[model samples]
Target: MATEVLFYHLTSQPLEAVLPGLLMKCLERDWTVVVQCGSRERVEALDAHLWAFSDDSFLPHGTAADDHPEHQPVYLTDGPDNPNGAVIRFLVDRAVPGSIEGYARIVLLFDGQDPEALAEARGHWKSLKAQGAEVTYWQQKPNGGWERKA
Candidate 1:
């Protein structure tokens, strides 16, 4: 079974340089990486690159009900009012039994602030971990980016 790792970083800093390296690692291990970025354009661009790397890779956006692959990298928008709304629901649903039963692991990434978003995400993380799923978290700085709040 693949180890589930939720690698998330929320900062004003662009993850363009960092993401490729991370993806490369996942590819090496043949791990299914579920990534969520706040910016649509950025995620779209990343998706394009991902497709170039792996034809089997898929990036579907928006709610699962309306989710359809658009080109490559899957990007989702958690609007101010809807943060942790659709994506969280989708992950929780997928993590449930039978849906993605064979999935060795589940990973969730999100902006680590916005009390509402983090609260909801934390709940899901805790529940999954309690069920024996390895849970990990990284929080970004609240002032401007995901830096340590100190």
Candidate 2:
């Protein structure tokens, strides 16, 4: 199946407040997720954040530094490798995906307040569109839900 690429422009909330919900949705669908970041610092920060982000619960995830990455429902990395065999991949921290094949979904979540992130996302959209890829853009609504804009 062709991979569906989604660009999520985060306007109403920051990533910390928004990511967990999306990951939960993917988990609900029984899809292992790979969240690729731009740096090891980000990997570490997310590793800790996912653990303490929730008041009553936290998303079960691990990183390459973990003993068993393959068993983690959500695997965090800064590379192109899919250690957990994730069907849905998330590209964050301005991390660009190397390839879009062999996945059910490719989600790019960018900060709407960052000019550079916005520009980079636009570039990705144009490049992917030119390649005849199935791409769509979604914006965060005031209510913190997603609204498809393209």
Candidate 3:
């Protein structure tokens, strides 16, 4: 069973300070990482920078199966309407039988600044738990650096 690691970040502010080490850990274990974020350009920028160490990192944009071959990070969008809803749906959709295989783990990276995004993330966390997927979340503090509170 493949592990589904869901990283849901509200923005890409602290990803540079946080994700590199975590990403390395996943790569070492051959775990697939799905970084769902609101900023596509920032996420891609992070992806381009992180490839210095490994090239297996990716973000799902559609039905693509780990489609990114380069070191660039895959980009997912969270537009205006139901921003958080889109993320929850993506994770749920991926967890369906045969949709994703192997050990499944999801890492949700979110920002604490946005009240709306936070509330939506918390609610969606419950939905994620109900779906039988292990979820972990991290938020970047105002001073910088990632803090895992849940």
Candidate 4:
């Protein structure tokens, strides 16, 4: 099966607000997820954010250094390693995956405010399409909802 590649253009909301919900959706489907960022600092910050993103909600996640990757429902890292055997991979903050295959879905979330991020996302879309992956582009609407653009 071809990997489903999704590009999320962050405009109305920051990743902190959007990511938790997406992760929750994956978890509801009984799918483990791996979120990869560009730097350790970013990954650490995300680890903290996921813990306190909502007062009523909790996301079961941990970093690579935390160990027990197999126990975590969601894993966060800066490297291109999938220790948890996640079915879905989220590439955030311009993080590029070494390979898109094997995963059931691959999500690329980039900031619309950054020109460089947008350019990188475009290149990724083209490359993934060329690899025969099913690609979808989502744009954040003014109401903070996402709309499928392509």
Local distance difference test scores for all models: 0.42, 0.92, 0.45, 0.92
Tens digits of per-residue lDDT for model 2, 81-133: 89889999999999987788788899999999999999999999988777666
Residue 102 Cα positional deviation in candidate 2, in Å, after optimal superposition: 0.2
Q: Which ten residues in a row have the lowest lDDT in candidate 3?
A: 80-89
Highest TM-score against the true fold, candidate? 4
Model 3: how far is 114 from its true place, Å? 2.3
TM-score to true structure, per model? 0.44, 0.96, 0.50, 0.97
RMSD of each: 9.4, 1.0, 8.6, 0.8
TM-score of 4: 0.97
Tell me the tens digit of each residue's lDDT in model 1 across 65-92.
2344332233333222222222221131
Residue-level lDDT tens digits of model 4 in 26-90: 99999999999989999999999998989898899988779799889999999988889998999
> Model 3: per-residue lDDT, tens digit, 1-150?
433445455444544556566555655664444444455555455545655534675432321223442332322333222221222222211122222233345455555566865676777666656666666665555555556666
Q: Which residue runs of candidate 2 sit more than 4 Å off their true CA positions?
A: none
17: Cα error in model 3, Å: 0.5
Model 3 residue 31 CA deviation (Å) reads 2.5
Candidates 1 and 4, the one with greater TM-score: 4
Ranking by lDDT: 4, 2, 3, 1
Q: Candidate 1 or 2, higher TM-score?
A: 2
